[model samples]
Target: MKKNVLLILLFFCLTDAFAQIDIKRTTKDNDLKLSALPYYNYGKGLGITSPDSIFQFNIRFRIQNRATYMQEEGEEAAIDGQVRRLRLRFDGYVGDPRFIYAIQLSFAPGDVGEIKEGENLNIIRDAVIFYRPNKHWNIGFGQTKLPGNRQRVNSSGGLQLTDRTINNAKFNIDRDFGFQVHNQNEHPDKFSYNFRTAITTGEGRNSTDKPDNGLAYTGKVELYPFGSFTKDGAFFEGDLKRETTPKLMVSGAYQYNNKARRTGGQLGDDLFEKKDMKTTFLDAMMKYNGWAAMAAYMKRSAHDPITFNPNDATDIKYIFTGSGFDYQLSYLFPSNYEIIGRFSTQKVNRDIAALAPDTKEYSIGVTKYVWEHAFKAQMEFTLDDMTYLDNTSKQNWYIRFQVEMGI
Candidate 1:
């Protein structure tokens, strides 16, 4: 009985000592007045703030796992699994809050692909400096995503579907070295306007030298006729916030690339010959009461046909003369479940109609947002049908399952 009492007393004494240390640490932390960090995954990331509020740093990491099954008509099926993305990001401000910067890196082997020996690593996803002088004006420079397509601009971590559409895979502006100017004005009566423009090196990212000494110009304008989305909600899918008021945005963009080297502008392999090209984008988004809808149209035209094997005179892979239309709709339930549907079509220009085939795709998916976009599982199946002018048709299908989690 005496030994038992002694043990209990010893336990209490150790607890008290630890408690005092914790109290001292908490008191010191409180005295510094550090600001709380912000992240989609609550309390998952790290942040540090200086005592004087002149500097801040935030770090985050995210990963995506994916599995896919693909089959072509009259062919064997293929199953694959891989780590789709492994990314680390850093974002903060230097002396002033208005002057901010961000650096993002991807370490996935698939993303890095096969690199040649003796070449420097080029895994920088985003490295940009931003200056938001006021609520109405902002300027940025460095390598970053170009404001092009709605789906492409949306972060992959926040998608309601398993993956992006084929149209995005074929014709997204991706990223480039550039300088951008943007502005937005919101009215007191639930209306807003936004404008953006950029001048970028026509070459894609990580290019040490410019091939043609030409630049690309891009501009976009948007109007929110039914008030702006809350917390930039339009960037994410499935109306998670369930806004009480309807929110709508309509935007249009135009781009001109002078002597573009690549077939897909800022992405894809270099063309056999450089050519000038023009691209147009139109999109609309609506969100109301957990219901969301989006539609986009994209068109690209080149000044002349691009041929890989000039002697054969049968190549048109780098022409980049086509149009695509995409539409999507989704509804989020109170239980954090979502159902989504999408349709997309692509048509080659008449000049290359015989060499290229038209494609139409249909897809449907479901997502369980266990913790909003920060943690979710998604599945989607897509049917792709291709048609030739000669009445020949081919069909292919693919199913994908993905899980995403991030801090």
Candidate 2:
């Protein structure tokens, strides 16, 4: 009953906000026209614009369906199929071009993950408001992706393969509720640069309570020595545009989570005791003509890895402290078909190697882009090898196919 009431109130609040836009214009002496109905475009989604141009909104949704088959050495093959992702996104300027808002919601079970009691449903992926006072500066508040690794910051829909590498799953700072400041500038025919910083709650997104008085701080900077890529290609995987000139971007980021309660800092299960965690990331991306390449290195550490339960010393959990490397190469053909290859390796600290073993993965994939990333089909094959703490080794082979479409 309470949830229903809250939903009703939210609906009314949104209706009122939309109505207030016209009400304010009616009281003024400015010329105002009726807003047009929503219209759809191929990649831009459905958009609605106010006659006075004071407000604009765009609604977009994407769905990803995937099937996977995997076999371990001396084990039976396993097959799985599911809706990998079902996401709805809304973004636009609220009152003026400088004031922008973005909201994204996830519906697929895999996208929502495991929801704990007393916490949110974990469906809200991003809900951020931005103040772009100028072309070079943007200030944002609310839940969003942190200033982390390049691949982690990139939208999942823009990947060249089926998904990200193991390095990202192990070391990337995914997202959190935070305040971010970003700045970007470019010198014509020379170079470009971007700087971003954030301060956030140490807990990951959708947490109902704060486990401790801790926070996370992150800062990142990127430099492009050969000018910027065509159409913000730095943020997405692959080089679909086939840049006429060579483009390269190098980035570095550092994050410190003071007294974080989660095992993975902003991710993983809750730890019995809080610990300070620090992470560093270095990465670079290069694109020339139809070819693109990327490489990243990540390392993380904690003051103390293991945490023991206060009442029961036998129960324990440890932070994953380790290093990882990921590399990728891809080429986009004029026919809108692309081929990609990737190699990734991760090594956990010996103390936690039992829980998170050393791993290496090799993957190759092909993607057919009907309309760039918005409408695409992907197929990938991967070989995964892991070394356990006991010196035992295991290997697996995986084959996956996925289809993604939006707008």
Worst 10 residues of 2 by lDDT: 33-42
- The superposed Cα distance between candidate 1 and the true structure at residue 225, in angstroms, equals 0.7
Instruction: Please give, for residues 134-167, the per-residue lDDT of candidate 2 as tens digits.
Output: 9999999999999899999999998998889888
Which regions of candidate 2 are displaced past 4 Å? 1-43
Please give the lDDT score at residue 54 for candidate 1.
80
lDDT of 1 by residue, 5-46 (tens): 999999999998766542322565564322332223225477
- How high is the lDDT of residue 164 in model 1? 80
Clashing pairs in 2: none
**Candidate 1: worst-modelled 10 consecutive residues by lDDT:** 33-42
Q: Which stretches of candidate 1 lie over 4 Å from their true place?
A: 1-44, 116-121, 187-189, 309-317
Return the top candidate by TM-score: 2
* Candidate 2 similarity to native, TM-score: 0.89
**lDDT per model vs. reference:** 0.84, 0.89
What RMSD does model 2 have? 8.7
